[model samples]
Target: MPDDARLLSHPFDDDKLREECGIFGVIGVVDAAQFVALGLHALQHRGQEAGGIVTYAPEVGFASARRFGYVRDSFTKASVIETLPGSLGIGHVRYSTAGSKGQTQIRDVQPLFAEFAMGGCAIAHNGNITNAVALKRELIERGSIFQSSSDTECIIHLMARSIQSNIPERIKDALRRVEGAFSIVAMTRSKLIGVRDPLGVRPLMLGRVGDGFALASETCAFDIIGAEFLREVEPGEMVIITADGVESFFPFERQRPRFCVFEHVYFSRPDSVIGGKSVYETRRRIGVELAREAPVEADLVCPVPDSGTPAAIGYSQESGIPYAMGIIRNQYVGRTFIEPAEHIRNMGVRLKLNVNRALIRGKRIVLVDDSVVRGTTSRKIKEMILDAGAREVHFRIASPPTQWPCFYGVDTPEKDKLLASTMSEEQMRAHLGVDSLRFVSLDGLYRAAGEENGRDDARPQYCDACFSGDYPVSPADMIERGFQLKRSA
Candidate 1:
């Protein structure tokens, strides 16, 4: 795994410290595969490494094509998109969390195929399965052959052996046995199914375009096709959309909603609305709260860029400070920029973001950023600002400190790798070499989210697992077990 602290060398890391996969499915469309391709293009920000689309026509059977590259690079020509012809399709964009070494190839591209007793099923999943290794072992013991090393493959295996006759029932049964965050879109010969785990740790929304129904990780994808923004797929709910129309089932007992808070703070596009709350507004509120909680007398307030822009605007509005773009990011730098040597990686930050010396010279600046995971990039950013002749630099974090690793889809590192997990606020301030540093309180974050005094059974509870160590699902020795087994073998 890459160093979590060093991940911020790339622009994508600044948007969200954690990485997540995106899944899109459409049913009842003339050019379903082409629509899925366009939808994945809109959601390319969610994941950039690999792209795949699976189409089912029933007469021609199921056809899948995928490539190991950005969606544009993978399928740019009209011919590539037109080749995947079907009325129902599912697409996926992936950023590997585990087994990313050799699996970066096209063979590992998703909408993985499984030939079951019923028929062929293709699945595209977002979020990690905490019990995948154990489940895979158990399934392998039962003589189930595996293909991909992705944790997502386990779900299909479980679905294949389910007692239910129909695909939807089988999927529902399989979901009941899984114990982690998963928002999945599956396509069989005749049906398309969408399911979210009981404790929704990821965002999944349903949309409509004409008579067709679409499901995507975020609403941003829906905007591309002018899909009507229907209500969110409920946590623990399974909705099957086919020629019969949309039908929902809650097969399992409901658990408390644990929607990933990082979605609003970082992962989601600013235009997206998750669980009835606007992501842009939520992040702006976090900035507002941060300013109120930790006010600083500064000459100017500057954002880290992109993700930090909204929060910086809010902070500037709340603090009566002038906001300026102190750091300019180079949009062209891709994932390859971070692959160089140490001195090159150090210089990579400058390539990605350059300080506007004129904006900061002799000014006391308050730097507003979303969150600081591993403090390496934060420390370097502060140094760059100081080097630009800023009189003083005070850092304000919009979200609370991330002290724990996320085992649910996100690529956060172990607890010890997190700067906040070990350092106190003052200690972090000293480490980053800033004049002062303060983080938003957990309560303040909830209050800003307008769920401070939320009822015990709210439908859209926030997932603060990274802030607080209260993980919705415990992955107990899974990480250790996998690493240990790999080492021993």
Candidate 2:
């Protein structure tokens, strides 16, 4: 949004899913914007491209600061934070799902604002609305002038046309017509509000940061600000918080929840809890499940580092292979999933990762990683390991092969671009040049996530559409555009 890409940092491609966004909101606090900043900082892994905060004060009114950079850089500046003064506020950290359609990229930064006939409200949203393009076209046909190309902006346009008398009622009126995943944080003059989609495909939690109430995309934000973890905002629930306390409503037809399974596998912070389970514990157990389902002999179990560390530890403990750091990640390297220009992606793994030849030489090694989207990273790593004199290199992926692209907000490669979409497991192993490659079974993934009896096909406990192609919500936009929306056989 700020046009800083001219600095020539890098382009992107990651062997993992691209995260969408993080949102934080607070009311009943003296420095509401600052608290929101801390919460967004804790949730930074969710989105990192740009951030904005909007606050309201009776003495001043609604004020906002949106910038294209890290939270610490944008929201932490005394000059920036001072401009936004209020006791109730909301904030958002965004990753560009893709490019916007117009020149108002600066306006696209959120917590997006709108002035209603009743009053003005500012909102920040996570997850994609599948019917956004259709809704936007319909809105424009009715003469709605739009400021941003974001799907979230569609919600604002719909709100402007609502006949409702109150902001919350108007919000409900607006959301009723949209479909797909959403977890929103909004600030009216005096209240902070939170909402989760009917299916709860994304995570949003309620907490108490003091006498004041708080809401965030993850519990890690509550931990960061010393808030007490309350509970999740249930599927289809809307919450409005004020000094009076919290009010809840069921604004949509209730359905069996389908929380995103990939959040437990890779997206969420290890310290955060989702649906009563620790993300780190879930990932670690996934590794244990992999060891049980796909046992292999190896000199040492080694992780790709950081995201792969917990699972590798579990694999080593379960299989009795000592774990080692066979690869070192440059901690300073920006996340690869955010880049897309082909030249930078083709530059490969050497930019962000390096092989620890001393740990890998002459020994059979098992490499534990979270997921493999294109097989490029895996192939590159295989070459590096072989060149380093490793006798045998086996790969153990913590999640099932991601054969289908996600339409629920994750920036997955297209179906045709997904390696698993076209290759058999044996074929993938050969292509990556690995002696063997194993992925945790889908049912095993369920077991790891605390579903004791494994997945319930009658009503699966999680959203695993990327693996099973069982989309709970119809991807209407993709379908209308003729992407042939059909489930995998």
Candidate 3:
């Protein structure tokens, strides 16, 4: 195991921390690596920090190329893409939640490789593994060597030790041993396997292209490859694609599906379908419900930016208020801004979003946003609206309050930093200096999902832990253990 000292320090600057990871795998194709590269390009919105691809051609065992920047920067050149050749492949686009800024160099880009008694395995993962620290300790004690600090690497070690007869069985054994949210795509000599946790905390979908099969974190990837939308990979299920064809395995007894609700509200592309509901439709319905639940007399409805635009339209339609582009976002600014000093860091928000005074001047405005994580950005936006000559600014959140931290892939703040965790709605309203503040109710959020009981086919229940504080997995003891480990370090 390598000493990963950078993990102790915060690496990401404030501006570049808003995206999730994406994974793609393909089997039984002539140019699988090239096709996977194209698929990753389409799903680039999910992650932008780093990108890589690993392919196993008949002549070549496992040829891999990875870089510390965007997918286009890494593999778009003719020289880079043409070099990779394989019929089985896996790819990853990463946004670091594990290693620090120093570790974010190329060494951290994944499809982490490990060789064992059974041969070799390459894994690309899209979600966080909560029990990783504990698991890594156990593996290290057993003499397993680790190349990276990423939690994804933990699964490779687990698979190497399992007594299963084949790769799929070994993978199933490894999954049963680990815990937390993970939507993984792993490739071996002859197989491409996709696995999802029992709670289904992250989204993973299956698609078919001609005679081949594909697996990705979102359907948007499928759109790029012209693959027909097959159904989602069921929670706790593992599907293995080989030359023989596709085979499904349910290694663990089934558990309730706790699909991450945030995916529909914020993370996923609006055009994608998650847990059977269209992301766009769900956000629109959230707007409709927010208008019904928190109606206010306002001259116009203005969205915070890209993610809030759909819900703002819905709010306008349901409330009979006109929708206007009151705020414009500078799309060219790449997720991070250049700040020479600590005093100027807050200015990043201004560079990202601005108020169009002509549309908002002298009017009562209804401001819509997807979620308020820390409330700092929300507070700033409200003040900007007030300064733009708005008579009043009433804030409407499209989703239920996020009161709990997510142990899954979403890098949510600690419980103490969450605004809703400590303060009442009235307290939060005063803190933000808004004329009024209201959030969509939990029941209303489910209803807006348009499912009879919020269960769409496979997932009969939703993961409302952030709003309800009823986690599917026990986090009380885990949090204490994590804290103790941090103190020891």
Q: Give the poorly placed runs of model 3, Cα more than 4 Å off.
A: 1-19, 339-344, 452-460, 482-489
Q: Compared with the true structure, what per-residue lDDT tens digits does model 2 show for residues 370-433?
A: 9998887789888988998999999999999999989887877778889999999999999898
Q: Candidates' TM-scores?
A: 0.93, 0.94, 0.91
Which prediction has more favorable TM-score, 1 or 3? 1
Model 1, span 307-409: residue lDDT tens: 7888998899999999999998988877666564656655746767899999899999999888898887788789899999999999998888988778888
Worst 10 residues of 1 by lDDT: 480-489
Q: Residues 1-489, candidate 3, lDDT per residue (tens digit)? A: 011221122212241124458999998888888789988987787777788899887676888899766677778887887778888899998776555444566767878877667767888888777788888998999998887878877888898888877777787888887878889999999999999988888888999977889999899889988888899999988998888888898877788788877787888889899867789989999999999999999999999888888899999999999999999998766543443344544464676788999889999999999988678778888888988999999999998888877767766666777888889999999999999999998877888876546434334477766776666665533575753221221
Residue 374, candidate 2: C-alpha displacement in angstroms? 1.0
Stretches off by above 4 angstroms in model 2 are: 1-13, 100-104, 335-347, 487-489
Better of 1 and 2 by lDDT: 2
Top TM-score hit = 2
Clashes of each: 0, 2, 0
| Candidate 2 residue pairs in backbone clash | 12-339, 12-340
